[model samples]
Target: MRKIWLTGIAALAMASCTSKTSTPQPTASALAALPTTDWKSFRDTFIEDWFKVSPADAVYQGRHDFDGGLGDWSPAGLKRQGDFLRNAIAKAKTFDAAKLGKQDAFERDYLVTVAAGKLFWLEDADFPHRNPAWYVNAGLDPNVYIARKYADAPTRMRAMVSFLRKIPTAAAQIRANLKTPMPLSYVNFGVAAFNGFGDYYTGDAKKAFADVKSPALQEEFDKAAVAASKAMHDLGAWLEGQRGSATQDFALGADKFSRMIKETERVDVPLATLEAAGQADMKRNQLALVAACAQFAPGASVPACMAKMNANKPANNDPVAEARKQIPELRAFVLKSDVVTIPDQEQALVEESPPYNRQNSAYIDPPGPFEKGIPSVYYISPPDPSWSKVEQAGFIPGKSDLLFTSVHEVMPGHFLQFRHANASPSLFGRLFVGYAFAEGWAHYAEEMMWEAGLHAGDPETHIGQLSNALLRDCRYLSAIGLHAHGMTQEQSRKMFVEQCYQDEGNAKQQSARGTYDPAYLNYTMGKLMIRKLRTDWTATHGGRAGWKAFHDQFLSFGGPPIPLVRKAMLGGDGKAVF
Candidate 1:
């Protein structure tokens, strides 16, 4: 549930500016006279503007300042936000980052990056109009349900009612602002999602809203649900009417895509280099998959072995409990085997995927430092009772796959990495780092755990891990190719099926996902960067150091770009923390 906002390179560009006056340097006394309050004020304004534009983010951070409110997607709202960020960026450059303390300087740098990214998107990318997934109601989007956690039952119902009332206005703005094609497609998806929401409310609201069984409450809930349903349907109908005429390309051209990579991952590599790396990793994973298959079934070829393994998927039965049972065993194996330091404060709790989030198989909900007593929920989606056994089997993790997924989502992965981020010295750093780092580290952890022999007892576990890696690497290729290199959906699907060995259904779903989320490339790309970073650092620092020591040191600095990591760790001056 970590909402890592995307920071653009423009922010860093603002921070990197230096005055070029030929005047004599100021005296030490004069330099010291510059008030720290000025920089603090700048930081405060940036944070304030950030929260205003991203209220869902504030709610997630346990700040309910805008609990009942939603984002303003109107053209006027977008212009206002853009103007605010531009003004903030101009103000930010006046403060000297070097004169501030490390933490304050990091905050200033982050604020600049955030503002720059926002401005870039608004002015250059024109994402609000071009991306279909921008408004889709998906499990990955935390905005719709954030208020549910903060409010009581009646209050939650009221919030939903209020949210529903605004949906038409928001939809109108979306339609006005968006390019013809993408919004229609997105609205189709959004309508489909809203259908599921209606079902969820019908099933769960009875008990939850018991105290509100009066005619008034029922009427309000009914009206809201009906309005939501109608709006979604109407949107979908409108989208269908324009199907043949829709003409917005979702691609983020090479320059913008490259900039995104540089700003988000701090990598200087070109798209070609990333593609080559991903291809090589995919080949390596294929070889590993073959090797693993040979161990599992000596006479079977890799494809045959994978077919057998897929056919032998476990039956769905209390998936959450079954998944939970594997965690302690996996945790113990990881710790005893010296894979990575499992923090003492770690607490992994298994929970059913919220009815709203059932589409995703599972997700790690890591608690922030501010949420100390709150348990980290490893949300597992249980099979719908309506599903046939065969249909259900596809999602139920077999014992080996269960352990592998647990290790990736919980132990020594997301839960652990986030705990470290939460413990960071710079609150702004904890608050502002991008999703590439968080997701990339978790994906990276999956491979690192396998390398450390955490999957030793079961070769199938190794194969499962490799299969997952292949799918992710393929995702990297598909995301970059589709969004940046003009790759077609058919091409991406072929890549997934042929290289990643994914089933046709899953491959198709993933290809559709790419149209909206170009950053899906981050999982594999980020992980590869982290692994390469670790290898280079280890070679420089000697291989004798414990993995725990290396890992602790690496994560001690809040999740900065990998390039910045070198400066953070090696630049002992402590001023390069961000």
Candidate 2:
């Protein structure tokens, strides 16, 4: 959850520059006097600062500039970064956007938006010091796997050693910043992950470090390994101190939550409105699920139908291998359907999720620049080998349910849309849009795929997709309820299990996740907004447009809010800017 930073003054100024310019006017004195070169310089500097603040983010994005440097989450460091962002914002405001070219204007708009968002977080939210997951999850371990694919083995090992060495300092900052009513659930999860990670290193360290002939490197790796063990120990001890005292109430209160909706998502709807919309969607999806279930198992109840569907799922010697086998077919379906345009260079690889990165079942690894041909990974969590079949079944995607998660996480979803985004010409488009739109587009894409007849041959498949939709709709409602309506975790879990028909264990995990990720609401909210935008766009264009054209145009602007999409497509300014 890295914050986007920039100011409104800069946006307004840049917008003014982009207003209906008649001619190129290359020789104009105003353009000549503008700080165009300075703006590009500033943009690079800002990106560098951004990489410095979140080095793990850089590695994830395939930037090896800060390979060995871990991010500092200390309060002093956060304040320093905040101060830097504020100063950058102030400097950005001084630029005379009225005299700049189109590219410069776009850059200014993006910088301002990013800077303002950062300043808002620094001043209004306790997020910097209060969230322990931010630090715990932002580690070098996950990136090591990705980076190792590209870097030499020894260089990769050295980077790992350097990263492990910083754990003590990183863990100390986390301990120092522990707020009242600590995020104990997240702490417990983090401790579990750290403990698992320590075991991974301890068992594999010698092999990973075997080729390093230098004694200095060997000693450094040993020292770092010891430090990491200590850090994990300290973290567990600190987590134990706040066990029963963790806050059960997950509300962000109305004002702050609303601000999040507006600033991060650029959604104009109130939280209550979003909640109402989610409930309606929940009901609609529930009905659809019931209808699909009845079609699959005539006259059976929803649960009975689900049991039948689950019963018929493919048995496997390796559940993870079976899941992996399904991915290529899904990707092929999305590509052949032409629902969304995917990059020619984008590599969609499936990898097992590391223990440290397994809070969720799957996530899309970020891509690098299109020119360099960076690959996107669809990370699937392998079932624990020691778990019973019953325990393992909870994670293994049922055959009928496989495409739903596939569409959401991979093709015609995050991976597909992000490839387009990374290749976007607008640097601001490349950097500054919100995750709500990004995640929302993916969620929307999943539903849209079904609507386009993805699983028309199988009623059970449709039921599974609808059930997943119900789950997300419930997430939207639960997120709003927990953060805007003061719903307790128990209450949230109950709502999910009862209405969403999620298993008890899954319900509990989702509820706990919502405490830290309130913006989970965006999946449904964004999808609904995208649907509305599509309908409006279709109606205005005589409903004659092809889905490919519509979807391509929609995604081409990167992941701006649906409202911004409407403005870009229908405002008739003819600029076609994102």
Which candidate should be chosen as best, given lDDT against the real structure? Answer: 2
Estimate, for each residue in 1-578, the C-alpha lDDT of model 1 and write its tens digit: 23233431111011111111111212223212223357765565456555556544544454433343446777766766677767776777776768877666666656666566566666676767765345542112333233234444555566555555555665676567767655333444444454444445444543456566467866786776566556645655655666666543667878888876654455667678778888898988999888888889889977677666666554445667777777888778777877566657567888776564444457766543443355677887766455566545554655566666677778777778777776676655565555566667778878877777775647777877887788788888988888788888778888887888776555655676666666778778778767766775677676735566678777766566555565555553322111
Candidate 2 matches the true fold with a TM-score of 0.85
TM-score of each: 0.82, 0.85
Q: What lDDT is obtained when candidate 2 is compared to the true structure?
A: 0.64
Q: CA lDDT of 103 in candidate 1? A: 64
Instruction: Give all candidates' CA lDDT scores.
Output: 0.61, 0.64
